[model samples]
Target: MYEFVTGPLAWIAFGIFIIGMTVKVISVIRLASKKDKVVFNHWSWGWSFRSVYRWLIPFGSRSMREKPVLTIVFFVFHVCLLAVPIFLLGHNILWDERWGITWWSFSETSADYLTLLLMAAAIVLILRRIVLPEVRIVTTAYDYLLLAIAVAPFVTGYFAYHQWFDYKTVLIIHILCGEIMLIAIPFTKLSHMILFFFTRAHIGSEMGERRGAKTW
Candidate 1:
């Protein structure tokens, strides 16, 4: 079971993630080209890049500044979300062993703190969805499920690292949850992970080039 999860199952998860995201990106671009050809008419790379950059930075946009707390938490959660997993010592070691690939890694202590921070942020996001009337109106069970999917790996990983339960079982659950997240990203609203750039670029170009207005 351990061997299969780490070997073939890992490959399958990565394969689906890559292929699914590629397909989605290509399809969206092609669809846009056909349906919204006007978008490209006045597309400005400058505005697009500026928009993406501004949105990437915390409190860079007016809307973000308006909600300072959420902006900080959102940025911290996402930064740690991407950072902790890829730079985790254990994950890097696994990649080194499996594919002869490795990168700079965080100390175990640093990873622990980042993981805890991520979990806390996830909780805050979940609560925000429930507590904020406007946000709650748009929230759905699927949204909560997606949040759970995003955070489950970290939760299980923390337990696995601490060996708080049966180490092997916790480790297995962690790997599985991580893989599930990878597989889900390109298919779900989590796709905002990739699509945010493209959509932001379109909006930025339209608003900036076409209307002489700032998007951010």
Candidate 2:
């Protein structure tokens, strides 16, 4: 089980992730090609190249600065989502051992804290969906499921690493859940992980150039 999960499944998941992202990128480019040039701001095609960097900062634009709660939620969730997994000491160690590649790692204690903050953010978003009337109207099962898929790996991983449950079983569950997330990214609404860049960049460029607004 260990060998299969760590070896074959890992490779399979990586392949799927790469292929899926490539396909999604192609789809976006094709869709963009069909869009009328008049629809975008007067700026050159490279506008997003500059404007995206600005809006990427939390509350960087006049529109977003007014909604600090939303900005905090958006910023914190993405940060912890990427940071916790990439910087976890355990993951870096495994990478070095498996592929002979090594990178900096965060202290395990820091990773743990970040993971907790991530889970908390997930809960807050979930509760908002349930409680807010306008949001609840638009929310769907797919949304909640996506949240669960995103959270499952770290949820199981934390338990396994902390030995809060059956260690062997929880560890297997953690590996399985992480692989599942990787495989599902392109196929699910989780595709937003990649799409967020395209959509946000387009919006930022349009607003910044057309309205003479600075996201920064």
lDDT of 1 by residue, 73-113 (tens): 99989999999999999999999999999989999999999
lDDT of 2 by residue, 1-216 (tens): 977898999999999999999999998778776884644535444566666666677777666788788678878888998888888899899889899988899998888888888888988899989999998999999999989999999899889879987898898889999999999999998888888778766765676667766545
Please list the residue runs of candidate 1 whose C-alpha ends up more than 4 Å from where it truly belongs after superposition: none
Worst 10 residues of 2 by lDDT: 36-45
TM-score of 1: 0.98
Error of 1 at 22 (Å): 0.6
Native-to-model Cα distance after best TM-score fit, residue 65 in candidate 1, in Å: 0.6
The TM-score values for the models, in the order shown, are: 0.98, 0.90
Q: How close is candidate 2 to the true structure, as a TM-score?
A: 0.90
Which prediction has the highest lDDT against the true structure?
A: 1
Q: How displaced is residue 69 in candidate 1, in Å?
A: 0.5
CA deviation > 4 Å runs, candidate 2: 35-46, 208-216
